[model samples]
Target: MAKSGNKMATLLNLILVLSLVLMISIAESRKLGEEAVACDSVYGAEEGDTCESVIQKFQLGADFFLSINPNLNCDNFFVGQWLCTEGTVN
Candidate 1:
């Protein structure tokens, strides 16, 4: 009986932790979406567009770009990916 109770408690704890993580993830994603929507200026990635190229084209600092596009995976960036070129996300 004690062992069963322990297992149940562990399972409940896992569920609670997972729920909190999921809630946090959803909130973060919503925040990022809001920031993207609030962007005053936007840019689309082109075939040969690198992060450096985009930064140079838009005259943005690397840190600023990262700050505005928190979800951007520069290493895995693809064509047609929209970026916030100017925004209040800073």
Candidate 2:
């Protein structure tokens, strides 16, 4: 009986953690952009791609690249994500 009770408690804790993660993910996605924005120029981040490397590849500066992508972190994006290379109206 104690073993079963421990399992139930563990399951409940797991559910609560998953729910909090899901809620935070939803909020963050909305913050990033609710809808996709059209891109004049775009870059698909490949493995080991960094802000400096990308800007160098495109012949742009760090400030320019970061400026075009507001609310974005230079080193916090996932691989294979597409980013706008040019600034677009929201």
Candidate 3:
């Protein structure tokens, strides 16, 4: 009985650890995606690109860019990055 209880406890601990790791990984991935610089426009976004260039390509202004990507920095952009900027009104 004691051995079974220990095994259950170990299993529960393992599950908890795995859950934490998964949560951390998900958060990290979201951060990386945010750090990336892709436009959220369905019309003009490729797999690897930056939102800055996309906004330029689309002829959008700085305010428009900010309105679109609230979490992004206009000055700093990265290559092969993607950003979500939908539902933003000009």
| TM-score per model over all chains | 0.57, 0.50, 0.39
* Model 3 C-alpha lDDT per residue in residues 1-90, reported as the tens digit of each score: 999999999999999999999999998767443433345464434644566666677676756666666766645656544555444442
For model 2 the local lDDT of residue 62 reads 74
Model 2 TM-score relative to the real fold: 0.50
- Residue 82 miss distance in model 3 (angstroms): 16
lDDT of 2 by residue, 11-85 (tens): 999999999999999987685644344558888988888888888888886766776766677768788878678
- Candidate 1 C-alpha lDDT tens digits along 1-90: 999999999999999999999999998767443544357788889998888889999999999888888888888888889988998652
The residue ranges of model 1 lying beyond 4 angstroms of the native Cα positions read: 1-37
- Choose 1 or 3, whichever is better by lDDT: 1
Maximum-lDDT candidate: 1
Q: Clashes in model 1: which pairs? A: none
What are the RMSD figures for all models against the true structure? 8.1, 10.2, 8.0
Arranged by lDDT, best first? 1, 2, 3
For model 2, the superposed segments whose C-alpha errors exceed 4 Å read 1-38, 88-90
